[model samples]
Target: MTCSATTRVALWATLLACLLNSGCTGTRYIPSQGQLASPTPPPQALKGFDGNARVELNLPGGYASPDDRAYPTQRANEDIQNWFADSGDDLTVAVRNENIKDSGWLSMLPYILTLGILPTWLTTEGETVMEVKSGDEVLFQNREPVAYRSALSMLLPSAYLLGSPGTGQYQVMADDQLNRHKQALQQYIQSQQKDYETAVSAGTVQAYRQYLQDNPESFFRMETLRRLSELAPATHALPFHRDNVALDNAYIVYLPDEYDIWFLGPQDMKVYDVLRLSREEDETLLASRIRAANQPYKVFNGDEIALLKEGGLSPGLIAAMIDASANPTSVKPAAVAPTVTSATSGAASPGTPSPAEVTAQPGMADIAAQCAKRYAAMKACDQVPSFGANVCRSQVKKKYSHIACELIQ
Candidate 1:
């Protein structure tokens, strides 16, 4: 070979070797695109939790029937646990054994040679879901995908060979998800400044209707609707539904506070009628909850609920009371002996305060209104739904995503 040709070959070999070795030890990457550069955290309205919160994690399933999964569910579980370990002081996270096909992915690479110039379209996507419950009621749920990206490298193009499939990206996504959940929780507490009681006390059917409309994604939607119907069974007879992906089974109806929330089904059916139709075993349980909250004119508050629970009152019973107090006219009188016992064994104990609805503190309303403006901006933009997905590849994608403000969920 000519001297110059030998020199060129040596240079190519050395460059390739460096690329292969450096790939494994590159500085960790933090993605800047498709995220809120300065997202105003969501508004929340809630009393400080009385005790530590419990979180339950549901594992991810395979996207396709790959006997060998790309992102194993257990690994995702570990990711979540490690995340909470840092920020979750008064919170506990546990796993639910059931699995789901949590996410899917796609890529583009017309020519292998292009891998050198462009990302070889290596993406691994998976969704992680966790739920928090206060008693039987799910306070909220969160599900978000952690997408992994790795460019094609001639030395180790196949991610499996490296045994580290997008590890850094996975960590970033997991941290982001945890932060979002924490923000949502704070916003929830803020929202309570305008609780069902506030909506009910406002007394307009419009108020009830507006509450549901403004918070279509709220966890308390179904129960809120049920309360509205009770306050004005005939006036608020209109049926409403939510369009959000997470709230498929939710709806509103006029049922007595005594009705078992779990007992809902076959819409338009009265509570007593449904109760009569339930299975023998379920019927007994339903009956017990109903009897505890059976008062025709009583509101149930959660704090007072712990006292009643030992007496067999279900957590859902407290939900019914919160709903009842929403009515401006639903008077909260002193707890009477006959009512207490009737509600639970009908034996009254004096000095037990009636379930009192707390008045709204200030500032929460302002937070909610601001979030509304943010939501409006996102809906009006023309770009793709997310930067991570890169739904639109137009020259104007960046400009439009900026208009979007924040991811809509």
Candidate 2:
């Protein structure tokens, strides 16, 4: 019940330490005079950092995966996300390798505790710098100090110190940090949109590919895809033979001008014209599949066509058929029946006999003379007005003499 002065002092110290929650109170941030190095990501690389009317984080140059737990940006990002959790904000930070820093306390802790030297022990602090981009513009960037004060804090638990500030000043500090990054993210997004417009007006497929691929999760992904689709291959049906059967059923037949002949079989469509073997028949045979391994196709113009037939026909009738097709009315007229005018006149034969030694056969000269006299009488005087002779008189003289003679002699 009655404690000494030194013992009482020790009791107070114990209560104070307990009030600090089994650990030293939080460390505070002082606005130091030094500047943090700003990130210099290319415009395209920063595409998704500001979109959806909200701020996004992109650290492609930071930790590649959670496997890189010691990465400085990753560590800082975890702190910021935890801080934002209470604010109902979702914060996701992409990681890259360069974000693994050599300056973080926990990273150095391994070397310090492992080496156990005075200088290593003295190195109890780390600095973190992040750019808060709105679009393509930066709002605030500060390289802040972080202090570790736990037994295991030397090699671990750096995140607890990253987003934390001095005791009794959490709301103010967290708000300050959030606002800075939010502004920067918004500015970055606006710049990105403007750049996208300029690029799209005169854009190429390569540029669109870069933007779309790099920022696949960007808010403008659909828009980017629209532009990309313009450059992508169209996905429609090509010139395919649709709803058709038997590609080999049709043939383009041709005839060249050369020989006259009836084109024989393989009749399909009858062509009406003079059938002349195509002068190109030899060439055609040479190029045909029957002659060569492959058939190199050839076209026959209208001029080369003499006939078109659908049925097999001989070469002999081809020329005749062509002529008939060309001129439909070249047939001779039919004969007419003759009328008998005199009973003594028999039907005349459609034949002629020789005039000289002609009217008499060798053994029938007398009968021939009698017939010639009758024939000469039947002839009109107009047949030989100057000599009082006619074609029949000449015939009668030849019948009497075996040689042709003047009618008067």
Candidate 3:
């Protein structure tokens, strides 16, 4: 038996490749890299939390068999600990138990013998208990199980290039399982916290109210109410005789005048009356009630009047509103102009007021024009439709009617 020169060379090369591959290959529990390096933990990935909780892994020996046999040499402990290094102080995660099993070093021999063609598999199955706590209070506890299947071949030099053989894949699987536990723990904490801190952190009445609405029985209910009162005391002072306290609370915040009409006591009416009558009441009825109530009229400023008009008060009702105001000069009626004009043009009639004596007031036409402008802006009625002028007038009138702007008449 004689061997060719080429065959001898090939055998030597094959032997060298085997040695290199064996040195680089690793099982799921054992990392292929000679030097074990910890990973930088991911950023704050938990929702509704600042990731201010400290995380700890109690798997002291790192990897272990199902029967309590530990693999103290494995870097799983350092890798997991480093992964959660900066996670936060709000939560502490303790690993109570972990088990990892994988095919040993000899498993890679078959892969090396087959050159780059054949592949060997590494499978790991384990169970871990992760316990979450918040300052001596346990928030969540759960058992997580992991099963990972991977293949090793010489075709890819990822292990050699990364300075680790099968460690990357195994680490990924372990991290994935830990992440799931973290997520579950996060959900549990959120349910317990009920976004109370998030709302408080915002420090706004709207945020506090929203928190109350979302979680009526929130742990921080008293604190939320205190904040709400500080931010907007009116919401708390509003007389709420209704069963739905939340709805009544909103009434004061959004419709204080309407709230007065419906909920004010007879004693309160004298002091807090808005004098803006019910929508169902006619101007005549409103005037009669205003006179009978004998309460000081409620005078609204320009901004208040604009808001009232936008709220769908009719022009006639607005005129009645002006009449109901304590400041009689707020809106001078056009009827007063006739007396002033007569006095100015002719000799000064007895008991007739002069132009200077009569304060200048917004006339009906001026009020009508102002209302029209507001209506146009509020409804975009000035913009003719793509359909052209044929439907423009009707559409404009329809919009005016929708906003109860009687300026068209």
List per-candidate RMSD values in Å. 20.0, 42.2, 21.4
Error of 3 at 186 (Å): 4.6
Show how many residue pairs clash in every candidate, following the order shown. Answer: 16, 37, 7
| Poorest lDDT segment (10 consecutive residues) of candidate 1 | 387-396
Q: Summing lDDT over every window of 10 consecutive residues in candidate 3, give the lowest-scoring window.
A: 381-390
- Give the top-scoring candidate (TM-score): 3
Sorting all predicted structures by lDDT, with the top scorer first, yields 3, 1, 2
TM-score of each: 0.28, 0.23, 0.29
- Model 2 lDDT per residue over 117-211, tens place: 21121113343345433334433344434322212122233423533323322223333333444445556556767866765665775665565
lDDT agreement of model 3 with the native: 0.41
9 in model 2: Cα distance from truth in Å?
Answer: 8.2
Per-residue lDDT over 141-256 for candidate 1, one digit per residue giving the tens place of the 0 to 100 score = 66554443443333343433323443443344444555555565656645753675676577665676677666654435544554555554443221222121112222212222
* Candidate 1 lDDT (Cα, 0 to 1): 0.35
